[model samples]
Target: MVESILGYSPVLRHCFRNVSGKQFPRFQVIKAQAMELAKEPGLCKEKERYRDSLVGLKPGSWPPKNRADNPSLYNPLARQERMGCGWLGAIFEWEGVLKEDHPDLEKQSWLALAEEEGRSPPPGFVVKRIACMKNEQAISEVLCWSRDSSQLKRMALRKEDIHQALQGGVYRFRDGSREFVNVLTRHKIPVALVSTRPRKNLEEAIGAIGIEGVFSVVVTGDDVYRGKPDPEMFVYAAQLLQFIPERCIVFGNSNLTIEAAHDAKMKCVAVASKHPVYELTAADLVVRRLDELSVVDLKNLADIELTEFGSTPELEMDVEEEEDDRRPPSSAAIGDGFW
Candidate 1:
């Protein structure tokens, strides 16, 4: 209603000025201010002379009754003083990003499962392929195990048991992980954790690590039908965090994680824990430790704006130019990007 009289762009720009240099404002603040500004005369002849239903209501009493027909006026990007400056969420991977799993433990678990089932041992490549997959998903999809739900459940539970025995029930944080988590919490950014591990095991591990209340959302294998390389877990995490998929930054340590994050339309920061820096070229940013990054780095990663075509306008233009020139464009054509 307010936008109909005073142009939307102009009114929201005014709201941005009023809320500048502070955290993003609630929709009510912008709506209330826009409605108040619309009431003054000389603003495009007061179209319809029909004030917003919200006008003249007490400041404390918001959301006039019977607003079923009213359209939503909230725009997350518009509320930002700048791109990525508003409320953003963080999603973290469990094994490689936050805690370091022992070398060969993953492969050993698969081998043990195969032996218990009287099957051939899985190769190293197979282990890596299923690194981010839930046990049942990997067993049925990659390993050609029986798809019966009861058998899948029994096999998945046994695999976790073998993994637990190999892991010795120990948990350890990666270098600088705990401190970085604390910094995000102190800055009021919501954090989420995603993993293919069972929720009961993950929650127990988190409790043992002494960071019980740190993560605002936790997504585990039990919560999803599939795992990484599918984007289901990351998407669910963003939904629970109440942030748009584009507003979430995923912290992970493998190419699989990077693939899943990009599939979910989220920015990814690859932690080069096991992989070398050159191998993680697909990530938006690569760092050796979590503390090496600050909030500014996260904001920069999420600063990208997408066109209706689902990619940045500059990228879209480059693709058009590539088609016009009948050749692949140089990497620098997009940006002087390291990845």
Candidate 2:
């Protein structure tokens, strides 16, 4: 069914057949497609407006009071400002490493795959199961569908293309990434780079951006058994920096990273550089640009108590229910021989 819908080859489908039963149960193929659809600009804006309306309503008020009477009732920006005060450490994802790099690489890659498969790609998502796979796995899957073995042989013969793509790719520092790093450094805050890219590629990109020494610690895809939405990478990074997860704040451009941070008991600030703001509602706060956030906001985030504001009941309930449905059965429920 998935292959027919997504135009995935039998070999590619086989690779993901057991993914849902793995450690990362959230990495299901169908869910990735659903997520892609939910991120459509129109749907995203509608959801945001709904959330904003809820935020404007009086807390715990039934039947919801009139907005005209409760004009001073809610301040969403103030809530975000308070949440920002509690951030002690920051974890940056590598999407922020290069500002002007191939913004549509995923789209292009998927289009290339579609061409190889001799079918039109599905709409609403850049890639099918490719987004859920690790960097190495995604590459292998693409190679498997190529027209001939020479494609692999050619890749072996010209390894420099890989290096050149990594080192000489069209990329630059994001609008205020350099300034943000400088501010963090001056304040003596610990900053770590947690990226899904391989260590060598990450190093080359960092070097290309000329921010080599900015990060105190770097965690790459090669260093982790599981990737984003697993919490392992972010947790490991926190441990390496000698800070508890709660003391760390993650800056990410994807829902996966935000979910991972929340799972690790860390606060996340969604950077809407690549994704829309509504798509990042799982994050503690969302900002249009990195420069929009300041040192004051960071300091404020570190001090605020999240429980005081209370959760967005409707959204939180939905997220919790979804997580519960995805959670694997407990070991005790399966008995001693389950493993």
TM-score: which candidate is best?
Answer: 1
Query: Candidates' lDDT values, in order?
Result: 0.78, 0.63
List where candidate 1 sits over 4 angstroms from the true fold: 1-84, 304-339
Return the TM-score for each candidate structure: 0.68, 0.54
Which candidate gets the maximum lDDT versus the true structure? 1
Candidate 2 lDDT over residue span 117-138, tens digit each: 4656634353533453354434
Q: What does the lDDT read for residue 289 in candidate 1?
A: 97
Error of 1 at 63 (Å): 22
Assess the local accuracy of residue 209 in candidate 1 as a C-alpha lDDT between 0 and 100. Answer: 85
What is the per-residue lDDT of model 1 for residues 24-46, given as tens digits with 9 covering 90 to 100? 43344545754665455433333
- Poorest stretch of ten by lDDT in candidate 2: 62-71
- Once model 1 is optimally superposed onto the true structure by TM-score, how far is the C-alpha of residue 126 displaced, in angstroms? 0.8
Ten residues in sequence with the least summed lDDT for candidate 1 = 62-71
